[model samples]
Target: MAQPTVTDIRAYVLRGGGADYHDQQGTHWIDDHIATPMSRYPEYRESRRSFGLNVLGTLVVVVEASDGSTGFAVTTGGEPAAWIVERHLSRFVLGAPVTALERIWDQMYSATLFYGRKGLVLNAISGVDLALWDLLGAVRQEPVHEMIGGAVRDEQRFYATGARPDLAVRMGFLGGKLPLHHGPAEGAEGLAANLALLADMRAAAGPDAWLAYDCWMSLDTDYALRLARGAAEHGLRWIEEPLPPDDYWGYQKLRKALPPGTLLTTGEHEATRWGFRMLAEMGCADILQPDVGWCGGLSELLRITAIADAHGLLVVPHGSSVYSYHFAVTRHNSPFSEFLMMAPAADEVVPMFHPQLLDEPVPTDGRLSVSTLDKPGFGVRLDPGLPLHRPYPR
Candidate 1:
């Protein structure tokens, strides 16, 4: 059978939480007192939004084939990303065959290398790549996992990321990852407060439930080591992203120094196989956590995972919702996926990209059956009611 060529590519930006889960309204645990790079300033310490964390909004990409079938994806990159898509990346996508993903991804990445080896441009490329995968799956009438490789397991287990680990334990999750609420700038007092909170959570969650801290790239190597030691008493399973994504030296030191039970993990903000290679080869982290929406999408992720597999490292993608779900179930190394509790209080299992997507699946009792993802593509539709704006059109 002949594959349809790409006919049109549309890029749109939307405000509020979708793929940019941080672009949420009102007071949410993800933003409240979460440690960050900007936490050195007293003004920005109280809220992440105070520093424009949500400035990127959401980038939506739609790839249309000559057969009139369209596949779309959402990621964090607002108007600036839409401009990159319509004015630049679309050239490689339009008129290409639906299955020409590797060529399309290479062209998009190479063309933008001068300005974008990482960050926003990569986010845009990831959006387009994911949409292309969706397009390929649609054209072939198959789910994405089937296209890449068949599922290795019948179900995908999940660990919840939120403020309420106790609630997540009750929800049947394998574990809960809490955001580290303080940073190095806060000093010893902050460290005490951090440990105290963990102790309280450990009491609430009980001893056997897996509990971990998501440092979110907000701690120093020394502080992270200290935090790990303090957390070891509470049986902390892991200390994730304690230092910034690029600090391989710090990661190497911290990983070696961490308590016996605590694993060192990072890489959500890191992009591409090249970047991840640094992490794997350097022995920087035990488990690599790349966001499919930011780490060059599924195409590059295939490469990243292969590298991890070679290095004997696990590739657990950060909160990418269904994008992670499809990939997780297929890979043996990705034994479980993450579910970011979107409920304002972090008390319930809301769809990770709520209001922006329809037919999105959430883990029932902390597990998603492979059958739940049997539908074609990613098995979800964009909520047409979203207030998406086209900043640039081609």
Candidate 2:
């Protein structure tokens, strides 16, 4: 039988009640820190939710094959991604052989160079790339991991990221990484408060459970050093994204200054193999955390992981849910995955994407069974009930 060709590429902007799951005042990364613009001013921080700041929106990409088999994926991009998909990327996808994803990705990346080498364009590209992988998996009647290289591990253990580490411990998570709630702008008092919170979580999580801090790209070198130093006594496994992602020199310095056993991790906001190359070459971090959704999807993540592996660095992807789960289980470097506690109170293991996706898998006892993801493609379907908007209607 002849291979199926992509007949159409369609992008949808999904927005509505369930879209803004992270929009709550305390839910955002910035809200945890007082120095960020969103939290700097009392009025803004207090009224963020009421001001309509919590917009849970995403861009969903669907690739339809000549044989009517459809594969789809979603990313954090909103209306802008929809425009790029419909106006610019569609040409690279439509009528192309589903097996030519590598060529298609290169064409799309090269063609968008004038306007995009990173950020939103890459996000849009990521959505499309993932959809292609899903399409190929469905067409070949194989899971994505099997299509790529097959599993390296039978199941994936996970660490919970949220307000409660004690609860995570009770639930059997490997560890808990808390969002740091202070920054340099808050001065010494804030720094003290930051350590106090970690200490509390440490006491609750006990000595053996892995405890880490997610600085959320809000701290300077000095602030991060102080926190890491303070956290060491409490048994911090690592400190993540303390400095801005672009501050390579800062990262190098921070890595050097940190305690010998303390690990520095970044790359959740970084993109592509080239960007990660900088991190590995400079010795900027001990672990690399690339979000498959944001770091050019699984296609690029495979490249990024290879680069990290060559350097003996770990590639624990940020909270990309199942997108990261499939890849994590297949690689030795990605020993554990991150499960963002998306329940309104951060108390339950609800689907990370919530109402936007159906049949989405959630970790049980802080681990996910590999067998659950054996279904063709990524194994989750877009919830049709969630209204999809085509912003740039053709």
Candidate 3:
């Protein structure tokens, strides 16, 4: 039988809550009282609440097969990514075999070379690649994990990323990663506050539960070292992404400067295998946290995982919900998954992609059963009730 080809590719920009739901609001790095690097801007400094910069609207990609079957995936690229998919990427996708995911990914990456090696272009490719995986899984009548080599473990453990580490501990999570509310720009007082917060969380989380800080790439080498040293007394599992992803030299310095046994992790914003190769070669981090949706999808992430495994590094992908969950359950290197608290207060469990995706699964007591993902593809379906706008409308 002839292979089923991709008939059409479409990108939809999804935003705003539907009739029954209000727009989801959440806090960000800049929202903290401390003076962040973003505070340098008059608009941000004068009224931080007004800056809705962290509100990354969603971009949904749909790939249709010749058999009338369709698959879709979502990421935080919004209108710009929609444009990339509609204008630049559709050519590479249309009429391609549903199983030709790697080829399609390579073509998209190469076609956008001049303007798109990373960032939004990669995000677009990642979304499309994920959609292709979903399509193939549906066509094969199997789940994504099976298609990727089946489950390495029957159950997957998870850590919670939110304001309430104590709450996470109560929920039976293995660990809790709190966002750093202060940056270097806040000076000594800010540093003190940051340490104090960690200290409080450590106390609340107790002695056995793991505790970590996500600096969100806002700190300098000096700031990170100071934070790590301060956090050491509290038993910080690791300091994550203190500096920018591109600063390999800084990462090396930070790793060297860290107190003994303190680990460094990054790559949530990094893309592709080459970027992760730099992370491994430079000895930049003890762990790599690549978001599969942002890091060239599952195809490229498998390669990234191999590199991390070879280098003796842990691959705890940044919070991509189910996309990471599927990959995590199948990789030995990815021992735990990250669940970003989407609840308004960050105190309760809620679907990570709430309102946008239906049939999405959330961890029960900080652990997810791989059996829940037995459904074909990524095991989540888009909410048809939610409006999806095609900005480019090809």
Candidate 4:
């Protein structure tokens, strides 16, 4: 047998696209789209699509060898995720064993216990962990999930989010998710308007369909309670991030208060399995929404989902089904995925979805399946030599 050779662990950073920067960043008048980052350049047009904002920040890692075999992986999306990858993960992951991905994750996660753990540390690990997976797959000539454990399904269900009432119809999602924007007043009227939006989406999506919404960490406990009650009336599958991620009691309390089956979904900003375990212990959310890019990548996500399952909860990842899309399909229980409601308009600044995805099959009848990924490593790549980042200080 011939020995497999690895050349170097490479890194790249993708920031906002320049052409769409104005639309992706400058606009704040709109509700949920403001201040939030884009993931890729816009591939198509929709009514609510921002004219300016673009994909915010993502990190891609390539593991290369002498034979031209390559492994590629990316951090899930979040504001500080890039810094985590550059400052911490790159240094720790220089010479890891491709066969022991989970072991390396355990060592790195615990190594930063004194100085880092939850937020930034985990975000960095998320990116590097992904790279390790890519390397493992490419080195051994196997799909990532196949090495760890075979996938649970071929395709995963997804909901058409971020699209407008009219355009959402055409996108063909199994369900629909919308942002619950702060409304005209802080009292009953505001509550009424929020409920009205859910109603409108429900009507637009039709009675047989499912609906969900997020507070985007903007609502208070009292408001979250009111909104959850309203959501019950509309038969929502869940109400996501009803309050800030920090409010553990709020999540738990809301979970208890809401009518059965109207779920409390959160953890998009949490850092590790510890935070999610806390939520799981208290019985907070019915659906634990972990962002792979933010929570320390696949390593932590696997741990987090295990905890969610132990507590008899479901996992609904937060994204347009790129990283999480593939991951969720591998899990027998990843029930749903998210779509952005509105995004940065600029093509140059915010990275948008790949144009090929527009034609891929969406979850039409309330189900999502993983698409086939035959390419080596993590199975996705980025344009070379663009958005050059400063060399990793490590």
TM-score of each candidate structure, all chains considered together:
0.99, 0.94, 0.94, 0.80
Backbone clash pairs for candidate 3 read: none
TM-score for model 4? 0.80
lDDT tens digits, residue span 225-320, model 4: 777777787888777786778889888887888877787888887868888999899988888888776787777788888998889988877663
Flag clash pairs in model 2. 19-56, 20-56
Q: Highest TM-score among the candidates is held by which one?
A: 1
Worst 10 residues of 3 by lDDT: 16-25
lDDT of 2 by residue, 32-95 (tens): 3333334445554434454344453688899999988899998877888889989999999988
Poorly placed runs, candidate 2 (over 4 Å): 16-21, 24-56
Ordered by TM-score, highest first, the candidates read: 1, 3, 2, 4
Q: Which residue runs of candidate 1 sit more than 4 Å off their true CA positions?
A: none
For 1-394, candidate 3 gives per-residue lDDT tens digits of 7889999989998775311112344553224443334644545643334565435578899988998888999887888888999998999999999988888988999999899888888998999999999998888778899989888997888888877889999998987888777676667887899889988988888998889988767788988898999889999999999888899999987898799978899998999999999999899999999988889999999999999999999999988877888899989898888888767566888888888888988999888999999998998899988777887978
- What is each predicted model's overall lDDT from 0 to 1? 0.93, 0.84, 0.84, 0.61
Q: Residue 175 of candidate 3: its Cα lDDT? A: 74
Off by over 4 Å in 4: 1-7, 17-56, 65-68, 76-88, 163-166, 183-185, 341-352, 355-371, 391-394
lDDT of 1 by residue, 1-394 (tens): 8879999999999888878899988889988899999999999999989999999999999989999899999999999999999999999999999989999999999999999999999999999999999988888889999988989999999989999999999999987999999899999999999999999999999988889999988999889989999999999999999888889989998898888879988899999999999999999999999999999999999999999999999989999999989998999899999999999999989999988999999999999999999988998999988888998998
Q: Candidate 2 has what TM-score?
A: 0.94
